[model samples]
Target: MQRTILIVEDEDILREIMKDYLLNAGYRVLEAADGKEALARFEEEEIQLIILDIMLPELDGWTVCRRIRKKSNVPIIMLTARVDEDDTILGFELGADDYVTKPYSPAILLARAKRLIESRYSTQENHPYEDTLLSRSVHVHIPSRTVTVCGEAISLTHTEFEILTYLMQNQGIIISREQLITKIWGYEFAGDDRTVNSHIRNLRHKLGKCATCIVTVVRAGYKFEEQI
Candidate 1:
């Protein structure tokens, strides 16, 4: 089945370019010129992914993302032209699965979109960690893709969940930022270390008391150690 992607960009030329690439990549494409129209299309279609631009009219991308996250966990990749690192962090905080800045290669954007969509809809029956990963009070059920701390469920964005799972899967081993970028966002990831840091910060916050399980190694990377 051809996956459907909604492109919410206010720029007509850029939107058409993205739509063309997605169509050629064998995906069904939907388009909206503004945030409000984006929301309407979202409500009307079975959108598998969203490529949203920040500077939209009628409503901003941040507002649209926050609203959609309330109802669905569908993958969303935010598009921005700003160089501010805070914008990237804000996107993650608003439940965005990926971020692409302006002047980006449409092919790279498509790759990111594909990665998120596939990861979300993967049907692999035999995962390496079929059982639950219990480290101290943090419980990660691989099959169900659910995380619970002290038996209390906590919400995690897709990227945050992947980061924690990878860390826990290789507990006691320091995983570098490069390794994480390749594993989670693919090699096409054009962001810097701050991207990883932002996600880690958010993940740790959600982990609460169990946050100590993830230890940062100065000048090295990060590792998961069982914390009691």
Candidate 2:
């Protein structure tokens, strides 16, 4: 089955370049010059992943992402021209799965798209998590990539999911920020450490009482204790 990608970029050259790359990589490509058309294409097609631009006409990427998150958790990769850290955080808050800044290599963008799509669509039967992980009042179903605390579903960003999954998988082990950046994001940089911290903070907050399960080590890293 060919996975479909929706590229919602306003730039004709960039959009077409992305389309060509993805098409050559064996994916079905959908295009939209603005957020309105993007949403329309999203509704009218079986889009598995989305490449969205922030400075779109009619509807901005933030609004489009918020709308999509209202009803769906489809993976979204934001394309931004700004290099502000706040923009990245805001993108995550808007439910974007990942992002690429302007002037990015098309090959890298395509690689990220492939990874996000694969991660989003992988099922319980294919990517088993050994077994469900339970601690105190928290329940984590790895294959399904779901988390529930006290019987209520706790929505997590894609990064949060991977962070929690990695920590829990190595329960009782101290995992460093660098390790997490490499393992989860597939890269490490000066700013990536802060990104990991931001995600951990948010993850802990979402876990509520079970937040204590993830213990922070001074000047080191974090460890997920099985019994708090």
Candidate 3:
């Protein structure tokens, strides 16, 4: 079945443009002119992802994003006109998987949309039902999706968990940022490699002293070293 996407924007021209591009990309597109209509459509449809505009009639995108995050982790990409860093960070804090600044490229937006959708579905597909045991000072619990470093549970975000899990599952194999982005972030990452670097930084921060389990090869990628 073709994945469904809900686009909430008040601008008719832009909305239609986005819809056309997404449709041609082989996605089923749904459009709402305002947040009220968007919420109504969301209730009525099995939407796989949402493209939300920050400025909307009756209700704003931030509120809509908050409402959706309360009940679902379905990926959302926020559309904003401002270049304010706060807006981007706030969107991420509100559970937006990504953001697009307007007047945006339809192609870039489509690329991001494809990436987010594939990331969500790919993680679901790659989720290991079977368990694995790791002997490193860190013990990763696949079923619970948790990592224990020296008997202390290390907190990790969903993305971090997925990245670590993928690495540990394929221990000793050098994996590149491109591979991780493709496998973990879902689609071909068109953005800077810093995105991957930032996530890895956060993962290591959470890992604390046990971060050494994840080895970074210079100019290469990363690998999970089995502890002796």
- Candidate 3's C-alpha runs over 4 A off are 123-228
**How many clashing pairs per prediction, in order?**
0, 0, 0
Q: Tens digits of per-residue lDDT for model 1 on 94-193?
A: 8888999889999889889989987777765645565677786888987677899998998887888889999998999999999999999998888889
On residues 1-228, what C-alpha lDDT tens digit does candidate 2 reach at each position?
889999999999999999999999999999999999998998899888999999999999999999987777788889999999898888776777777888899988988888777776776677656758877677888766789998999888676887888888888899998898777656522246567767788788889888888899988899998462
Sort by TM-score, top down from the best: 1, 2, 3
Q: Estimate each model's TM-score.
A: 0.92, 0.89, 0.65
- Taking the tens digit of each residue's C-alpha lDDT, what string does model 3 give over 55-174? 999999999998886666577888999887667667665666677888889998998888777655654347554465575577777655567887887755556767888888778999
Query: At residue 71, what lDDT does model 2 achieve?
Result: 72
Ranking of models by lDDT: 1, 2, 3
Model 1 stretches with alpha carbons more than 4 Å out: 126-128
Best lDDT among the predictions, by candidate number = 1
> What lDDT, from 0 to 1, does candidate 3 have?
0.79
lDDT (0 to 1) per candidate: 0.90, 0.84, 0.79
Clashing pairs in 3: none
Whole-model lDDT, model 2: 0.84
Error of 1 at 211 (Å): 1.0
Which TM-score value belongs to model 2?
0.89
**Whose TM-score is greatest here?**
1
